[model samples]
Target: MKKLPLIMMGLLIFSLVPYVESASVGKASIDQVMLSLGESVTFGDYKIQFADIDQAWTQALIKVYAKDGSLVTSKVLPTGYSLSVPDNDNPLFYVRLAWILRSNQKILISLESELELVEGDVQINKNDAYNLPYKFNDVVIPAIKVKVTNTYENKANVRIVLPYETITATIFEGDHYAVPYKLTSDFQYFPYLYLYLKNATTSYAVFDVYLPKYPTTVFQLGEGGAGGTTPSAPGAEPTELVYNDIMYEGENLIIDINGTEYALGLNTVGYYSSFTLFDKDNNPLKSFEVKKGTGYELSEAPLVVELINYESEYKRAYLRVYAPRGTEVAPIVRDPKIEVSVSTSSTELLLNDELLVFINVENSGRGRADNVNVVASIPTGFELGSEIGTWSLDTLNPFTEMPVLVYLLKPTQVGKYELGPVVVKYYDERGIEREVDSGNPLSITVYAIPKLSVTGEAFNGTWGTYVHTQEKT
Candidate 1:
């Protein structure tokens, strides 16, 4: 009976071991949770609470605490902004305020952790090797070399040669194999390389490699002996490396020089291949079309690319790229100037007379004006007779004038009035709102009609007697 109890106790202890281990290393995430003021939630080893909110709700106060009941940080987070734990450069946890609902007195926040990804796909033929480079500080070194030994239908044999050891595996289609590696002496052995076989044929095989993390420092190999040193000599400048790689059409080859990342994309493959260079933001910096065995130099950015060879069957191009200088470019910005004028058909008019008003809007600047609106003001004694007071155009190009906007107005009362300084509102190309008005208001005069009555009493009434004036006057 005692032996049975002992066995049960041992099994219970073993079961709890994995649970404790998993909890210690597990990653925590919370997707967009709505929390009210003074609400709190616990995730992994951390606790997050919504402490307070401002009256305008534009900002919120958030408090974070560790599992040991100790406060980690208290921050005032703004809408559309985020607060990263331990700073942004090496963030382990993130507390982002997506938005706030003013009507409900609740806030939407998300807690997340940064994910480490180092995955890519490569195609290699039998007996060919692909080199993966590791960047430590400013020094670049060849970290691993992957070679294809053999390939059959749906399976390929690969050899992963590392600095310390070599590993071999047979990967079938849709399956993967992980190889353990240590980037530096201070790190533990992790699954640094994963080879996922996408397709395997007699000639070649395609693999998707995943490297979750890379070492910040590496062992240095020397002629005299093997020793550890800093990435480079003291006060020594970082050096650039020429990277050689093979890529198919639409595939991107990434290179980093002097902490700036550049991507070379093969747009088309032919006798005359075309490639485009992009910055880290994927903005095209330059483009080139060169024949095989020729090179191109980008003047805007200090980079050179040379095409060595192309395989028509595989649609792959072997390329060599390097950055020898710094980038030299400037951005150009243009402004839009709007001019408005108001004109009247006649300055002087009689009562109950109709007048035609014309509004001319023009863009005289170098940029285009968007969402142009023209507004006309009616005089005090005049009423709008034809068309509305407002006119709109989608866009007014530079040095362009819109069609004439004509409206009619009738004078309701006889008086002198001023017809208006028309107003124009528009947005520039940079989404800036601008307002412009006509230089001066147009003057108008309304005069009353003149009435003339001629009453001629031509009477030869010099005397009271009325004589027969047939002959004698």
Candidate 2:
């Protein structure tokens, strides 16, 4: 497992995201909300609606339309995500309940309307003392309560930004609006929540903060100056722990070896985690917990550990794992080694000449890649059609390569041109995704075809004589 610098890893992850496509219709939508899809509903200042969403996946491309029949925005909305139109006084929109599908790539629409924003009636008690920014005890899994200035309109645009994600929704005003969030144990970062009141282009950002979860002390051991469970802050937030890395159960994970030190710890608030260990060289190894027959481990060295639940059923158990003497633990993500090369049919061409571009994708890694796509960038001013778009391969096995005719175009003007720097995106067996850019763009020169009729004098050097031809036309 080659190590990547922290900054490089972040940028690599960011670069893998592709441009969103237009959302097609879906079958299943989120229920629980009472509204039909495509039904034009009016609210504050504008009318909004959407086509019935009949699909369900992790991500959905939704195109929103305002009352003017103009596109509001084509947004990639995820499950549990709501986007508030900022700075607009009119808040006519509603997103029906959607059923999420695998890969989180698609969604099932519930109602029949074009995707619209939600609007409805909500009543709040006047006696309640509203807080400016509500504070949550634990962001990882805590209930959130939102308090907004009382508005005559029942539904208002709400925009929220979590540490890892952002969402916009039409808040159905009520006595009080409260939502609960369950943070995944996937990525590590601090929690920061931002909410906004979106009305047209003017948005009033909400204020919110997270207070770390305090541990519930079960008992104490090693009295006096000896040893015992770490001191507990019953009322204060717990400091970030060193052994906070969590691996879920039934995951085929890759473990990267960090510096020379590795340690694992379990908390009272915990889930089951068991895994096998293995090294980068495919070496097998085991952790001490597995030797005692209390946990799960699939292999050695760079082990595959399955984290299930607590050690016992008491709702409280503690365990710690320390990596073998010389290695630290890191997450297993898809690391694809893909190379892209491109070539054009000809280095030179005449105006209006048809040209073809070829792209080659080489997989020099161990993982099996799927959904390999290639897209070419044709130089500006070239005549291109939809056919000069994306090409794909169902799969590219490890140590193999694939080639595609990514683009075909005809030059309409005479000049130098470039075509290439094809972009490649693919997913490995474990759902590790990767993307790559091809080498420099391919270049071609185009010369305008000479269109002329000539009648001139002809000369023969071999004969040492010059002869002029009149009436050569």
Candidate 3:
């Protein structure tokens, strides 16, 4: 029984050893933030590299040093199916992503890493073979990496041909690209390597590879006029994975989450998708027009926004905002259609008589209205009263109406005056502010007040000479 337990313990540790991290855990946390660029630090099995930030006064892009593998949220196997990285930190790391706001304040971050301790560091020299010195405990170093630089003006297709190995490279002009190559056998001695650069498609030798009669090099598509092929690198394996060129999607307003596209900010309303849309950053736009091609930048990353309409026909909804792809959201339907009507107490106004104006505004749609204001433009002949011909309401429920009355008096000698159409502005079901034209211009006639003169002919059957109080009545 004792022997069996010991055997089991040995097997358990052995299994864990392969996945067990070979590096040391290290972290450097500070209250202050560094604003300089090109700063770097190494700890445990990780190296953090920071580049200059242009968009912000003090910002840095922290890149973790991981070659050929990724740091996941947990110690689980890489299942490339799920697009989301769990918002966890363990074997994986999570960077702090924040809201859509800009300020002059500074931010501080503490970077942590796991780096493998080595007796010596990796190195490469100019015009010579790579000198990668790796140390292992009494065993052989299994892998080596070399990054070749482009010394020419145009970006040429580079191929590394070595012992039983073949690798093609696509690097920016005058920039260096790294390649990791594994060895079949343990490192016994230094091996020779060869490099070749040529036109990518034509296989035409733009320049002859300067092989130091040491390591051999790579192969390509076109062989005509190109340098002779040396022996392939050792233990070379053909790869199904794509390298060299990067693929980009078209302008369908799609946000690229990793390599896949997650489309947003559209609905099934087809032609009715038109509404005043605001981005996560910018405020309400001037143009009220909405169309398929319209877009605003919310962020360069994958994020969703909660949108609340001020006074539109559509209800408040969460939208994955960005340039929209072909996919769309549900159509816009005015649940509570709003309508406004206007009328006058009397079409004709007698001279020295006041006029009463009545306006009936209703919410006919299914949704509610928050802001509703009615204003009447005074006719040229009439003077405005204390109300200023304006009435405002805070809210109007669907299928409800509010009546308003405005009194106007002192018509400036009106012959025939036409009052302007009343304007009713309110938010529709979507919280979109929209104004409706009420009744047409009102026409009124102002005639002088009639004068009545009465003479008492009964001046008296009696007191004829009585003092006739005939005064100006």
Candidate whose TM-score is highest: 1
Tell me the lDDT of model 1 at 473.
Answer: 32
lDDT of each: 0.64, 0.40, 0.37
Task: Say which prediction, candidate 2 or candidate 3, comes out ahead on lDDT.
Answer: 2
Superior candidate under TM-score, 1 versus 3: 1
Clash count in backbone of candidate 1: 0
Lowest lDDT 10-residue stretch of candidate 1 = 16-25
Q: Which digits, one per residue and each the tens of the lDDT, describe model 3 over residues 1-473?
A: 01123443354343221122223322111111222234333322333333323243322233444333354222111101111122222332222211111231222222211222332222222222342333332223333433443333334444454345667675432233333333223111112222223322222223222211111111111123211111133211110111111111111123343343433333223322333323334333222222222222234332323221122333222222421222223333334566766677788877788777766677865566767777778777788655532266656766677645556556778589887687878776677888787757878888877799776643335565554554535
Ordered from best to worst TM-score, the candidate numbers read: 1, 2, 3
Model 2 score (lDDT)? 0.40
User: Could you give candidate 2's per-residue lDDT for residues 6-32 as a string of tens digits?
Assistant: 554354344323211125221111122
Kindly list the per-residue Cα lDDT of model 1 for residues 1-473, writing each as its tens digit: 01123443354343221101122222233433556677675544556777777666656677777768888765666553456554445555667664454544666565544323344468889989877656422335347899999987667888999888888888767666766555344222244456778888898998876543222222222222111121233221211225556667777776655467777788998778899989999999888886665456566555656666787765767765544323222222356889998888899999868899888888887567988888788889988898733377667876688867899999988877987788899998888999999977888999888998744332465544553343433
In order of appearance, the predictions have TM-scores of 0.31, 0.29, 0.26
In TM-score terms, candidate 2 sits at 0.29
- Candidate with top lDDT is 1
